[model samples]
Target: MASKVGHPLRTLVAFFIVIAALYGLMAITKNWTPRLGLDLSGGTTITLTARNTTGKGGVSATSLEQARTIIQQRVDGLGVGESQVTTSGGNQIIVSAPNVQRDELIQQVGQTAELRFRAVYQQESTTPTSQPGNSATAGTGNAQGGSTPSAKASAGTGSASAGATASSTAKGNGRPGPALPTEPPAPPSPRPTAPGKGTPENKAVEWQPSQQDITDFASFTCPRDTQYYPDVSDQPLFTCNEAGTQKYLLGPTIIEGTHVTDANASIGQSGLGWQVNLSFDSTGSKQFEDATRALSQKQSPENAFAIVLDGTAVSVASVDQAIAGGSAMISGGGINQQSAQQLANVLKYGSLPLAFEISSVDTVSATLGGEQLQAGLIAGAVGLALVILFCFAYYRGLGVVVVASLTVAFATTYAMVVLLGASVGFALSLAGIAGAIVAIGITADSFVIYFARIRDEVGEGRGIRTAVETGWRRARQTILVADAVSLLSALILFILAIGSVKGFAFTLGLTTLIDIVVVFFFTKPLVTLLSRTKFYGNGHKFSGLDATHLGVTALPGGRRRAGTATRAATQTGGEA
Candidate 1:
């Protein structure tokens, strides 16, 4: 009699109950999905081939990974969600962000993030004249054609050119016009001396555009307007006047984004608002120092430099001295708590070592993916039906054991796949499905070994009830060895291979494990219990383990009688 503790159906039931509870938990925790590949989701894919710009064998894998980190930061800073950045073929980087406009993402990914400071001349006071109605307003200098004595302009009240609507019309000459005179008859203060032309009143000051001015400048879309505002045709060597309250003239960047070692955003000491702290490598530090020192000596506006990010002015600050420590802080009035945090994240991520190139990017319509999913299910169903049919034909009543064991294996495997998909980023790809199909054969082989062992025991004249126990003893060793070899092969495949082949190895390993568990916990117990039943114990002709087929006569009390020729002949003659 089979022990209750080892009964197959009971164990199977308990296993299923545990799995069901886990499934419930999985459902509550997160939505499961086999993450789709690039082809299945519409996205932008950029392939960047590495160029040895410095001829130092281009970049090492480590450096490339760092570059990826930086690029990821820039891309994510745009507020796009769940972007993918990976390396491919050793020297190429692939970037994909689903549903984002390709042009916008491309511009963000390609920037070399070089920030520089350039000083601009500033005066003490001025009047607004950029508007036609404001033309009547007054402030400092002569309101005549060129060659009028200059008037001082304050930091905030400049840019009063009549009808000059935040256009980039500045002639790039770095010259500031005299402020409008406040009183028309006061005769311009005995001609105040020019700042750098030897005047006691001339002191270098910070010049930045007002917040309203930066906002106006940000609204501009170049190439649609007059020739005075040329669109950024180059990689934007310079960001014109401040988009912040402190307007600055920026020269071309001397250090690229790749040289930045780290960047973080934090609140200043006063706890007022957000600011970004930046650090650069030795080479970048020297360049930054040169840029700042040159800009620091100029008068207001001319004494400040602009930090241009992706062709827009995010901040502009003046340097009081040459920042020799290779670090600096950028304080922007518009940056708030949340935005500052995101900027910090961007800078932190922009220094990892991952590179990849998209080999192809094509959209898989949702309808088509649905069709594919349906087809995969149908294929799985057909394969299962064929296995069941073949088992029934050859194994007869023994096929029930095969079917039961396989069902349990399938349940466990499915639950794991779903859970893994939810937990890790695992996805059910076409290759993964193929792996599962291959595993079915492996699972079936384990069942065949088990049943054949039972037949072998019965042929050795053991009673059906005894044969069940003896068969399991022999099968255990064989099953363990077979499973071990399969697992080892899977490990080898997993470690050495990449892409879809690894999926195949993974499924194979998982099913092999399930096969062993079923054999020990479900199959052996079921057969042992069934052996105690009347039909199986008596060795009925259709039971697939009948004593006649094995040349043994089943008797009561766990005994079997061997065939005797002489007795058989005498009995046959009497019957004749």
Candidate 2:
């Protein structure tokens, strides 16, 4: 016989051997965990409609996109992992934060995120002109405007009143003047203060703002309109107000989070724990350099900028010098591996031009999700069992191949799903399970096609070896074409549909791809090898495609035998 391009026995053996090895590795890796979705995990999902509160709700794609960007920044500030942020209805934003504490998440998510950093002017507390690592000025002047984290005391007529003190202070060897005592009665204590009254010490510090804070041209009713700019490089230590209070006044952001191109958490250079590494685009790099240069000229606290996420400060570091490059590293105390990873995720995903506001908030109890999951599993089990039963009743000894192939398919699918969930934030929903159930039919059809093809070749008077080759030659094309159609449908659905339908489409697409792989690699090869066996090769009656049962007529003049089984050719000559 002339050799065929694809050997059936070789194909079958190679497929099963590879699948067996993959399944074994998956099992060894414990790739059996079922992933829980947001509903199952019991978290908060919020929807917000983006409307210009200042304007008369004039909605635009730009506004929607801006809102999404802001919302992502806000959500990231919350440090929630695998959170879903997307837009819908052109005006609404959807946020799904799974495994998050609902009420707290709601509170954090509900607020329109605002980023601000104000300069330090005068504080109500003790003012240090020069701290240990850095130094600054303690002028007797004041800016009678909004307090900033890094505001200098303006020298005015008040300088005359402190002339005597100034001379004495200047003569004291250019050292930082001591902070005035809280109480009086210590005559000539060198620390200048009004007699019998305590004066608030004033310190100069500039506020560095983030890009969000700067871009946000929001107006609010406040006693002071202090402008804030943040040191984009270094994290701030203690932002002080002009009133001598430890209040961080932020400036307009020179760089925004949008400038970041990529972010990831990894082991710190010191081998301590996790730290987030960030890289920004050209614009962000230039802005960062300028901001850092400005801060380098300021005091310690003012020389630092705070990375404010949501409403809380995640980090503060001092900018020793200007950072000319786009890359930066954030390192601090006890940033856990999980938190670092979350930060990286937020930064990485934040760059995508995706934003959403919650239009609805629903909390399905874990019990409900559990029930649904249980039902889905039971349904899958029932379907598998039914398929098994049908194979046994129809195929006899060949039923074992059907069962084994199905098991391998299941193992491969489950392992892939679990790993995808872990690696890509893929959550298996009800629709996904249904897709898997539907896959049962597809896998079964593959077996039926192969078996029927073998029988057709055998009925044509070909020996088992030739039948296996001819059958595969015919069956493989049909399987590929059928699967191609299914895969195309899945791709279309996944691309065009939304919500749960997309979930269905995704699973369908994934399974369709897997089906093609298994049939081509494992099933056909294994079946080809099996046809070489004595039981199968000798046309055992128990083999579902046995020629005797099928009433296969080898020749036109062949005599008919009574009580022989009969089967019709598949009408379409292809698998379902």
- By TM-score, the best candidate is 2
Off by over 4 Å in 2: 1-31, 38-42, 47-94, 97-262, 297-302, 309-313, 347-362, 366-386, 549-551, 554-576
Model 1, span 82-123: residue lDDT tens: 356776666777776654566555545554443332233221
Per-residue alpha-carbon lDDT of model 2 for 393-461, expressed as tens digits? 888778887887777788778877776765555667777788888888888898788888877665655
List TM-score per model, in order.
0.53, 0.65
**CA lDDT for candidate 2:** 0.54
TM-score of 2: 0.65
Q: What C-alpha RMSD separates each model from the true structure? A: 14.0, 12.4
Q: CA lDDT, every prediction?
A: 0.53, 0.54
Clashes of 2: 54
